[model samples]
Structure formats: structure tokens, C-alpha cells
Target: MTTPSGPTVPFALARFATDAGSVPGLVVGDRIRPLSPAELGAPSLNEFLAAGEAAWDRIAALAAVASDASHSDGTTADAAWRPLEAVTLLAPVEPRQVLQTGANYRTHVIDLVAAGRAKDDPRPIEELREWAAELMDRRAREGIPYFFIGLPACVVGAEEVLELPDYSEQHDWELELAVVIGSPAFRVSREDAMAHVAGYTIVNDITTRDLVFRQDMKDIGTDWYRAKNAPGFLPTGPFLVPARHIADPGDLRLTLTLNGETMQDATTGDLLFDIPALIAAASETMPLLPGDLLLTGSPAGNGIAHGRLLRDGDVMVGTIEGLGSQVVRAAAARVPA
Candidate 1:
């Protein structure tokens, strides 16, 4: 029912539910212990993250105590520490706002540009790739990232089933490294953006490829609301590793496998605009509150690029280095018999 840990020594934070209710918890190795809100003086993870870098240190102190209290030698910890497998893990954070980036990966955008070429154009795929790569390089040097807003209502835990909307059959998977905001950021510069990050997590940004473009209004661009806001479309987190535990967010590896086949395998470094730029750009127009998610964009190897879309009973397992991993399955909605 539940799962939980991380890269450096394997420790992290997450929300879990039991028969009593739900609580935020610290996971060390294969065991977990709750961090009561009253004790931390913060009602939820949003408040806790709003506490800024201090919250991480406070959680560190809690981890020490939890580890001490959880000694296996039959103590009151019998109820305090539970095996990681016995709990139900929820989406690590309940973000008020989710800023999603599009085509921010260098190679990814090149792949997309090459994929969308007109059939009449006689350029070879390799040559087209080269031209697109040059264009992406130019954009990286002189461009801001393409961003879209996402609904938090779509957030769901990794274990949840994905009911593919029958309205479109071109659903795709895009696993990415999600930055968890700590302090409120408004118009912050790129140099100062990293300070506002509380931690990191994995998000599978599932999309309906065909619904992305506006069919009715041909002039209008992508319609993210209809294309991306399906229930359980954003499958997030098995754990939220504190920023302190991650050496470098830009260098982390992101991987997603579908039904045992590798779909996306890339590193955050492939992003045309890195995490700091994303945070700075996203926060420039609006305030990014604590617990908000800033997605750093997805890499290449998407269904649109591959032409192989999701089907009923397809399973996806997404992982990010240092943060954690998530497992999700797609199930088509059934009609009444």
C-alpha cells in the first residue's frame, strides 16, 4: 500500500495514510516514522516548506530522533516505526500551483522539430536533426523556456490507476525532474532561484498528443487544459528528497519504462533551460508559493516521436536519481455492458 528513501545514504520525506488518517513522514532505509504537524509547528508540507531551509534542518533533527526511537529492540517504537511496505504513500506535496515547461530539453526539441517536418521536404532525417539541433542551440542561447500551467487536481500518487480518457487514444508519457519550491518566489533572478528549492521529486507528465494543438482555433497554440488536466495525469513521488541530499539537480538522471521497455532515458542536463532558469522565469510573472512544482521539461523519446502510444494495461515506472521512483498503470475506461 505504501513505499518510501533517497541517494546519499537513502533518506527522504513523504506523506502517508493509515487507518487513523494521513501524516507527513521521514523514511530511512526500509523503515518510516511520522513527523507530527503539531510537533513541527507546521500544519502541512506547504507550511513546512515555507519555513525555508530551516525546515530541512528541523526535519534532520526529527530524523535523528525517529531513528533513535525506532530501535528494533521492542519499545514504544513498535507503533512508531512501520515497515515501508505497510503504508500508503500519497503525492508527496499538495502544491497550490504547478508550472509545467514544454520543449525545454535540447535534444528533445530537436527530435520534435525533426518529427514534424512536412513529407514534401526531402531532407534526410539525420540532416533534419542536425538543422534542428542548430536551431535549438540558438534558442538556448537567446530564448526563455516555453511554460504552461497545470492543475493540482490532476496530481495522484504513483500507485493509483490511470484511467485513460476515451476521448483521445494518443496518450503519452513524459517523466521529468520536479523542483519542489520552499520559499515564496516572485521575480527572483536565476542566481537566487536555487535557494528557494526545498527538495526534488519525480512527475510523469502524461499527455494526449493529439489534443495538444487547438483544432477549432487553428491559429491558437496548445490547449494544455484539455490535453493535460486529466485525473491522475500527473503521477508524482514515492519520496521527496530534501535539496541538501542532492548534489546537483541539473545532473540527475531521469528514466521511464513502459511495460518493461525503456521509453525515456535522459539526464536533467539535457534541459535547454535548467532548474534555476525555470524557477526564475516562472516566478517572474507570478509568485511561486511554497510546495509549488516547477517542472524542468521533458527529454526526447516521447510517444509523439516514437509513434507508439499508450494502450490499456500498459505499465509505466518512472525514476529520478536522488529523488525516487513511481509506478503507474494505464486502464481504458470501460463502457456499460
Candidate 2:
């Protein structure tokens, strides 16, 4: 299951079942190679990532040797290679921190603002469009990216079922590209931001639409914590494709389908602030640790823009070019009396 040049193999780290229980594995073509305790040195992908670049280099080297040996012996089948379908895919990594960007996609922001104005404004349609365009242009030049912290405890594997909170009726889906930090980063420049990235993964940034704004305090604006950080709110991964495998993160296409219908589809090219900008912006005040996740915002066609909020029994399928896809099913909340 290993590749001749392990570094070139583009491994997707995951956790799958073992006689002893679940263990971290490196996903190769149609099989997974379990990591030994000596190789892993830790139980989770989070620790593996924090072990530094040298640890990853060693993994790649070992994989390359295994691959070479397998090919040379003419016995490519090894017991270590387990069927991919038989294994359970856990969240690729347990992030130390989760950072998410808001209103970072050009079309998504414009659509939201325009939709709000259409509901209550008396301005002409064309005038409203003109104003929105102008506003975006000025904001791009003068504004910085808006970021919010998310609770890592809310993260779940892609295959896990989503449980809706009883208090919110308007649960929504936001498909975004998530960046996994490879090294410690603080006050990093945009020019050198890409180097700090270890890999890319998929994240469905689910939101409670009704709770986004505090009705009790209008001036307080958005309440991201309450609205976005619920258990199973963030369904992430199926794979974490190495950054080296992704030539350009900004050019990847992202698509999301809800119950067999394509709801959100867009490319990363539409991002108002690209990956480098987001990394630089996020690292300005806080240090980004290995395995930390930074979500680069969602594109247009979210439920908020289309009036098609998620409901119980809804199934969401999110896909990002190069990284992989994630399917999450939603269920009604089981509230206790």
C-alpha cells in the first residue's frame, strides 16, 4: 500500500479499528497501513502532527522502503494493507484550535448583503446591486479578514451523524476548505504562509441560522460561538491530502449537495482573501500550532442565501477538489425534559 516515494504518495491519515481498538493509519490507494506504536510515538493524529516535520519525513522514508521492498519481492500483497472499506475513518486530526473566517468569499458576502437589502430596503434593485459592489470593493481595500475561534470539541468525523440542537430551527450548511497548520506560526508574513501548511482537508461549517445574531443585543452583532459551536457542528475529513499534492489551494472547486440536490458550488478562486492572507491574518494575534485548523470561509449558495435551511433527516455531501469528500446525515435533537 505504500508508494515508492512516500513523500510523493500523498497520504491521508486516519483512524481505523484494530484488535486492540482504533489506531492511526496511513491510507494508500485501496488499503491502510497501520502505524506501530514506535512509528506513531503517540495515539492520535494530533500528536503525530505535533511531532514536527522530521517525524513526517521519517514516515515517508519508511513507506518508500516498504513500497520498494514489496515491488522487488513480487509479493505486493501484505497483511499490513487492510481494505479501505473495512476501516472506520475518523477525523484526520484532533486540532488544538479551530479558527474560522467570516464573509471572506466575494460572492457569498455580496449575495448576503443584497438579499438582506431586498427584504427591507426601499432602494431600487439596480441601485442596491451597485451599492453592494461598491461596498465590497472598499472593504477589500481597507478591511481585514474577520475571524472567530471554534471549539475543537464540536468536531466530528465526516461519517458521523449530525445531531440538531432543539433550540434552533434554522440549521444551515457551509462547505469550506480547511487548512492544517504544520508548524508553530505567529506573525507570519503572507509571502511565507504556505510553508506553514501541512495539508488540506474538508470541513462542513454547520451553523444555527436563527442564533447568529443576538435578538437581545442588536449592537453585539453575530454570536458565532452559540450559533456555530455545537457538538457535531463541524463534520470534517475523510482524508487530509498533503499540501505538496495540492498545487494551488485557491483554485480548487468546492461543492455541497443536500438530500440529492446540489446546494452550494463554487471555486476557491472567488475568495476575497486567499489562503495566504487568511494564514497571515489569523497568526497575527495568536500562535497557530501543528494540527490547528483554519477554515477559509464558505462560498455563495448557502442556505441563508437560498432560504433552504437544513432540517432533521437531511443528508449533506461536501466535496473539495484534491482533498476528498465527506457525507454527514442530520437527525432531530433528542432533548431531555
Q: Evaluated with lDDT, which candidate comes out highest?
A: 1
Query: How would you encode candidate 2's per-residue C-alpha lDDT over 128-187 as one tens digit per residue?
Result: 778887887788888899999999998888777898888878899999999999878899
Worst 10 residues of 2 by lDDT: 1-10
The C-alpha TM-scores of every prediction are 0.93, 0.89
Report lDDT per candidate: 0.84, 0.81
Clashing pairs in 2: none
lDDT of 1 by residue, 1-337 (tens): 2122333444788778878877888887666778888755698889989997777777787677666765565233547777767788888889999999998998888888887898999999999999998888998999888889999999888778888888888999999888999999999999999999989888999998888889899799889998999889999887888888888888988888888889899998888888888888888899999999888888988888888989999888787886767888889976421
Segments of candidate 2 deviating more than 4 angstroms: 1-9, 17-21, 41-44, 51-53, 62-76
Off by over 4 Å in 1: 1-10, 68-78, 334-337
Clashing pairs in 1: 2-87
